[model samples]
Target chain A: MPKASAKKSAKPVEELSYEEALTELEGLVASLEDEQNPLEDSMRLFERGQALVAHCSALLESAQLKVQKLSGESLIPFEEESE
Target chain B: MQPTLFSSIHLTVSQLTLHIRKQLENDPTLQDVWVEGEISNLSRPASGHVYFTLKDKNASLRCMMWKPDAARLRVNLQDGMAIEAHGRITVYEPQGTYQLAVNLIQPKGEGALYQEFLRLKAMLESEGLFAPERKRPIHQLPNKIGIVTSQTGAALRDMLNTLRRRLPLAQVILAPSPVQGVEAPPALVKGIQLLNYQLPDVIIIARGGGSIEDLWAFNDERVVRAVAESKAPVICGVGHETDFTLCDFAADLRAPTPTAAAELATPITILDLSSDLLSARTRLTSLTLNLLAEQKAVISSFISRLKYISPERRIQSAYQHLDELSRRAFSALTHGIQIQISNVNGISKRLLSLNPEGILSRGYAIITRKDDHMVVSKVSQAFGKMKVRVSDGEFEVNRGLDTAAVIE
Candidate 1:
């Protein structure tokens, strides 16, 4: 269900995965180049594209790997299990 | 001597051998047994029966295994190989010797474990569990990754470090399980099943390198089946580069070590993604600018042609043409009048030369008869009164007297 919702652009740029953000950005560029979209529509597409680029760059800039354990219903930070 | 030892029982050689065979075969411990020893003097003749001597530091026993049992052996039998053999003790009456009848044989230590590994590998392969089509391609960019490994083991730390260095954006879910010992096989199965519920893009089952006995859990049939059945593709990294397990065969992919598994999971690094993003950003700007340039060109061309044929421009040019024509006509009229004046002056001068008044002015006199207004050139032609005209006055005269004087 989460992945299904993620496919739509309604999700915020920060929440979108790298693949998702890049995919939507590329789509916007193609539409702008190939179609005679209205000026207002083109402006909207361009702004969204810029935001996606920023989000992707930020993700790459400040990322840290996190490992977690699947508890009953939540994920907790992974710790060493006692032998 | 027989009479002296009459109290003891005397037995024939064949009878003694048969009695000994019965005693050994009838014993429950010797009826079915397992013995461990080093092989020596191993031989296989034309009869297809294998004969060998099983020995240790203290004693040695002759052993025989039929062709059927030897054919089922997974490892090659050689002299000096320490092996565990299962059969019963039997005595050959003719040779009068007791030997082990080996129905099953396996090399001891790691060799025994390897034999079982081969057996399971063969079985799984025959069932198509290790088929090429069964293998799935790992996700290029996995957002969520599931790992089944020992939380306390070095393998877990190595894998985590590798994942962090390559792709820090990925979220890893650890399913802790023991990687060795008798309890490890079921625990690994549970770990794989638990991760399956989360629906990760990939699952990595990993453990550090170890001896064959220490890594035998990965060769467990239950674990191998679990790996084969995982919904997400599994990458088995159980042992060293040279070590292999049945789970490795069943997995979608295999890596030599836990760190290698982490690397395999993240085929694309953060650097690669960053460059891709940069290019996409560049394309977005360039494409939009190009579209604007194309539209500007169209608009400018439209403006140029629109200006070319406007009515305002046409009327202004027409007014300029009218002014030019009127100026040329006025100059032409003035030139024609001047030419006419010169012609009139020349005609008037010529007319003055022919005028009689002009001759009289030169002091020439003219005489004419008044009645006919004719001039007389000979005296005989003058008969009536004549008129003489001068520049300022005129007088009348008689023509007969003049004519006679002229004739004299």
Candidate 2:
């Protein structure tokens, strides 16, 4: 049964950040609720939603690091990551 | 007089006391007392009685002024006054001490430190420093707000809280400064300068309530000038509702409290902005729809006009014109036939004028040879044996009978 399901599975080609995934999820929800899209587009959105959920779960597992610098004046080093 | 009182050994207590008070009141040496003193233990009771001790260089006297006499005094008595009092020295039997009962008082010199507050107020007013026309208008909605107050005071907390609740979008620049004491005025001026350099949209100078002396720093000329010269609009919220300062007059706007200043800085709510945006969108939609409707009407009218000049209608008009031309051609044919008939009649009359039958009636005859049935014009053609025909009948001619000269 697992080998039969693997042949039919559909996933996104590229990985997405948390914010990008959330934005795509919101757009997908809006498109599905619009009532103008056909059944084919609705199926595509359901498949994309599964990939976004997996990506969001991976981001939650990672811990963010914060660094502070003080030389009479205090400053916080910002993280470098693309949305 | 003492011997007379002594003689009356059985006198009543009231009579003896009256006689002794009269003797002391009449004494010239005890009538007036001059005291140069610093006042101590000064107590002004609610009943308008003043009880104080007046001390000189070496000694001090307990003094009491009743409500009536204290109220009548023109000068305000304070801790230190080198004064002279015009009254009799009296002894209180209970305390057993001689005290000066002040009747008329005069200051040795100007005693109570005269504040001259009105003088400074007049001087500032004369310079047109408090003119309402000179005041700048506060921004209706500031994008950035600068506050000049002590960082740890209640005024700062009130201002920050109010701003956070009312206008959270504004970027607040806190320029901390002392609000009281001698250093307060200079610190406030420096804060205003710093904010001016940064150029915030609005500045709010604020402090909590205190006594008159504590709030006097706001009246400093330097602070007032700093507020006046600031490029940004300044709002002065010094002390409570009752407290007014020179900075309040110099500022563009004055709020009763720090919280009120925050409210004044940002007047509109989110609902108002949203409503404005909605109205603009509605207007734009209506204008676009109207323009589209007008364009459609214009195109439709043009199309109708174009239909009038279409090729099919032009061809139909040409057909009607051809029918009218055919009718005119038929009329021309009838007129041509009549002209041709008249021409034929004229030719027939011309032919009749050349007729030989007509010529015979006019005494002319045509001659013809009988053999050939031809008309003869020459005699040579008719020989002796030939028969001739005249115009009316036939005749024979002989040559012998006609022996005449042959004319050439």
Candidate 3:
């Protein structure tokens, strides 16, 4: 049934770390390569792997240094010295 | 005792010195003594041994520290520095002199601090705070990093620059604190606590190289305990490679410099991570495509296999066999009818050949006496009126007339 994979893909892709996304993508590749899964399950895994690859690429493209200070309870912007 | 015969058999210098060496080496009070004195005539020879004389106003003692022990000394030795030395007293038999083989030494002013450091180290070690199993592995890719250092110090800048250059994806949370001074210990402890509240993946506590007193805050009991108890793994980079503090021992990992800590905090750089992501995507694509190809092949093979055993084909074959059987039956029925017709024709021909009517039509006749209806084969037997049979008629006077004509 489609119910098993529904829970797996429910988690938002934006919330995953780059490492997490890469790990999941690698796992999907391994399972798909195993050739034991049914056609329906293999398709589901491929879809998930595609999403993870996209998420990882997006994370790589969106690289900006974020330095902040812990002031009281909040994290304020950190002013870095000019090189 | 006879005083004239050289009293006690004049002892050799080597033999006397050996006796003195044994006496001094065996003395419980002299061995393992901690002597306090001002260092004098300190000379580090080419052999790496420190040959120094320690003297007070009353007397002086010759001290020799081996290369290994001398290397372990944290303080730079100089003449006229008041120090406390610990070692066993032993005699130099060649020179017939006694000296202390010093293994441990501490400057007089800093000696008490060193004693306290040792005591805390031993206590924390017993508590398993510095256990290898207690050390947590640093995250390969830290999303959020917490740093505790002086904002004005070069260490913070170095670490920031290194992190920004290597991996800018990580968000750094700086908890500025005085790294050294009387106010530093409590501030450092508070800074670590504050970072722990944020729950960053990793924490870096660092400062530039300095004297022991200058970096004493890291050695403070409160700071070391804070590091040991940190929720997130702590990386201490408080001083240069040679300089160490108690916090370094308590931290999950030790780095020689602040920059090194920043580097260590992110083991995988952005470039490597990006390449890895691309490779994984490629593998995922290729693997899925290969699976699809295999599935397609399986489906096609299934279709071909189904064609061989399909019921529709079997039904068609059954229809062909039924048609062949009907054709054979029809041919058999026609052949049997032909044979029956031939038999009937043969029987009718035989009956026709034996018919007496055919002989009558061919001008042959049969006669019999009228009295008993007997057949007359000879002419004398047919004198009277007799019956005669012909092919088309029957007559009574015909035989008599025929016979008379024959007689005439």
Candidate 4:
């Protein structure tokens, strides 16, 4: 059911890492492949899958690893090692 | 009676000490006894023999551990360290003092702790907390990965570098807590809760290589329960490859080292998922195109093969056949008319000989009255003036007698 995807909207697909995006994209691909599926839902999943593929590829091509630490409630940049 | 006074009455101090030493050495109970006391005045000389005073609050005994026996000491002995020494009690010959000739030494309270560790392990193990079925499989690829370890510890550095090199796309959140000491247990539990609330796909609780006491925090009940309660799969890497703790049992996966935890957390790297995504995309694209081509071919064949033979072509063919037939008909009629024309011209010569116009052209005469304007068939029909008519010329003669003269 597309309702399964309701939680995915909270975290933007673009913010997801390559693995996250790729996992979601794979699910979407499987859903889209079902010919008997509703066209409207299929189209939405197709669009998201396309975006995920692009996002995953872009992240793979980029060369940076981001690290953050939880402070109070928010994430702060952790750079303790550089000092 | 002769040797009586010196021999029978008393002996020298050396003989008395020698008899006492032999008596103590012959006693099975005093041969080897375990003496537990605080060590005081410990002395390890160049000869490598260890000499120490084993004392309780009441009294003290001189203890001597031989060089080879002291070399077997697993636990270091200091002046204040409480120890349990095992050896025989024998009197030294010159000083004639009875002391413990120590052969083995161990820490006083460590065995009890080890027993407690074993007891707890057995208790928890019976409850199925350490059952293999309870362990969740590690997520194949984790996006949000939480790390619980000391911030300044080398384990944290190692995990960070490993994650960076292997899979940069994984987002890491550090939950820093003391990984050692008495305070580490509750702190580590809190760290686990915090990461669990962060909704990470997976978590790694790890520490570098450590002694049993240093890593005892991992065996803490609270830490083990926290690991067991996690919704996300957890990887426990508490010590070196040879070391394992109760946390390793409660964890979903046990990694031998912190770097191994990192490796297990990031099962698929960016490069790996990238290639997989590309492959999926290629398959989807090809599949779509194939279906489209299939439909297009059906449509094309239907339109070309089936609809092609419909009325339009039929009318064109009909028109072509009609034109050909009409052209043949017109040519055949013209040919028949030309043949008839030649046949009539050949027959016309015979009919021409019988005609009077041809005979008159040779020579012929006829007379007619002028008033009637008709050719005279007989001379009697001539009026007062008769005209003679011939093929080439006409003459007038008087009455009927002029026929013959008119001709001359």
Q: What is the iRMS for every candidate structure?
A: 1.5, 13.9, 1.4, 3.3
Which portions of model 2 show Cα errors greater than 4 Å? A1-83, B1-116, B312-408
Q: How well is each residue in B205-307 modelled by candidate 1, as lDDT tens digits?
A: 9999876777889989999999999999999998889888888889999999889999999999998998888888998888767767877899999998988
**Model 4, range B76-104, lDDT digits (tens) per residue?**
78889887888999888999899899987
Q: Please give the clash total of every predicted structure, in order.
A: 0, 0, 0, 2
Ranking by DockQ: 3, 1, 4, 2
In angstroms, give how far residue B272 of model 3 lies from its true place.
6.5
What is candidate 3's lDDT per residue for A1-83, written digit by digit as tens?
33343246467778887767776676667666654777777777878888888888888788777999988768999987776
Pairs that clash in candidate 2? none
> Which window of 10 residues has the lowest lDDT sum in candidate 3 chain B?
B396-405
The residue pairs in collision within model 1 are none
lDDT over C-alpha atoms for residue B348 of model 4: 90
Q: After superposition, how far is residue B190 of candidate 1 from its true place, in Å?
A: 1.3
Superposed on the true interface residues, model 2 gives a C-alpha RMSD in angstroms of 13.9
How displaced is residue B72 in candidate 2, in Å? Answer: 24
Q: What level of docking quality does candidate 3 show?
A: medium
Better of 2 and 4 by TM-score: 4
Please state the error at residue B297 of candidate 2 in Å.
1.6
lDDT of each: 0.87, 0.67, 0.87, 0.81
Judge candidate 4 at residue B311 and give its lDDT: 96
Candidate 1 segments whose C-alpha is farther than 4 A from its true place: A1-12, A33-40, A79-83, B1-107, B329-408
Query: Lowest summed-lDDT stretch of 10 residues in model 2 chain B?
Result: B109-118
